[model samples]
Target: MILPIVAYGNPILRKVGHDIDENYPNLDKLIEDMWETMYASNGVGLAAPQVGRDIRLFVMDSAQIFSNMDEKDKEEENYPDAPGIKQVFINAHIIEEHGDDWAYNEGCLSIPKIREDIYRAEEVTLEYLDQNFKKHTRTFNGVTARIILHEYDHIDGKLFIDYLSPLKRKLLKRKLDDISKGNIKVDYKMSFSK
Candidate 1:
């Protein structure tokens, strides 16, 4: 099912998500549904807060992207992690933000079709946990940088649209409201709901 992406103006997007714990229920299924919702909505990444969960978790899938590069090419390009299947990040922690900022065409699943050029760090280095709860850190570039940045925003109580200019933000306000209301396609109730 396509889980409803909490829209831009929603208060949940502005509320920092709380850290997850051991006693929390449905750890496995929550990860599964996040992957399903991400694919169904044609998103490469998603955060729990984006789905109203208020938990420090996000899911990412980078399939259908560059995956067959040779070792030499990967070394030269510096993008080695071609995402496999759907990976989950729980209790993520950003230890550093590095490199200069560059502008790219960015959009949000919550905002649907609206797209804009947003500046983000050219590269990022951070630590996050895999589905198995193992810790890993690596540099991300290009589109991966964009995806991770967007998901990080969910954890920090912010949205992509918040970075827009006043006039541009005003222009999107009504559309955002419409998307938040009921005009856009979303499925909040899942194969199971809490």
Candidate 2:
């Protein structure tokens, strides 16, 4: 099912998600629904908070991003070889972040239609579990790391907009307010706090 993504200003988005174990109700079904919702919404990543669930879970299919990029664009963007990475992350924690921070244009499903250049570390080492509750500690870099970092923030009760400077955030106040009140036009279904 395609769940209605929670919009900005929703209190759930501000809450740090709790870790869930394998026995969590309908874990497989929820992950399936999340994938459907994310692909339907044309999002590279989706966190549980975005769908109104305060759980440490997220899905990413950055392969879609690579499919849309041509060779020149890929070369220019210095995008690494992202070969159709489709994975689920549960109870994730970033163990460490390496390399210098780089600016990347980031966006979120909760904060629809708002994209900003956010700075993040070039690489991240994460410890997380897969759908089956199998644990793995992995390191990611380049565009993949950027996407993971963005979604990781969601589970931590942080938004990309929060990284903006005071002046930049102030300038986007009206637009953010509009999003909270369902004043923006998004192709996907969204639930607002109003």
Candidate 3:
């Protein structure tokens, strides 16, 4: 089941969600659908916020297909190409963060067709639970680093574009304004000052 993804102007995308006490009814199904959506859309990450859900959860799978320097996915990565598996995080919390900053190109499922170079911490240690409510702590770096960073922002009502320079922000202002005007289907009603 492919879930319906919200676009760039919807208000729900901006809301800071609360922790999930339990995997809500249909959560298992939603995870399945989100996995489908992420694969079908060529995205390594997908957030509940992008799908119009205000839950503190998201799914990430980065080893889908890595673009080769020679062609546009014309050849599969050296490995057999893992189609992508669903990783669920319900009511996740980041207990600590320790790392250097680095820049990498990133794209969003919600804001389609737009890619930008973004800087994020090189390493992060997070404590969270899966859909089954099992606790886990994982430290990730590099590409996986990018994956978790993107999804976590959804829970915090922040976007990768928010970390851009003032000049770039000004350049994207018109587009964001267009987003606010309903040109795109994103949810930007955020509240994360707490």
Best by TM-score: 2
Kindly report which residue pairs in candidate 1 clash with one another: none
Candidate 1, residue 143: how far the Cα is off, in Å: 1.4
TM-score list, all predictions: 0.80, 0.97, 0.80
lDDT values, one for every candidate: 0.74, 0.92, 0.72
Off by over 4 Å in 2: none
Which 10 successive residues of model 2 have the least lDDT summed?
75-84
Q: Kindly provide the TM-score of model 2 when superposed on the true structure, using C-alpha atoms.
A: 0.97
On the 0 to 100 scale, the lDDT of residue 22 in model 2 is 91
Q: How far is each candidate from the true structure, as Cα RMSD in Å?
A: 4.6, 1.1, 5.6
- Residue 69 error, candidate 3, Å: 8.0
Ranking by TM-score: 2, 1, 3
Off by over 4 Å in 1: 67-86, 185-194
Superposed Cα deviation of residue 183, candidate 3 (Å): 5.1
Off by over 4 Å in 3: 65-86, 178-194
Query: Which wins on lDDT, candidate 2 or candidate 3?
Result: 2
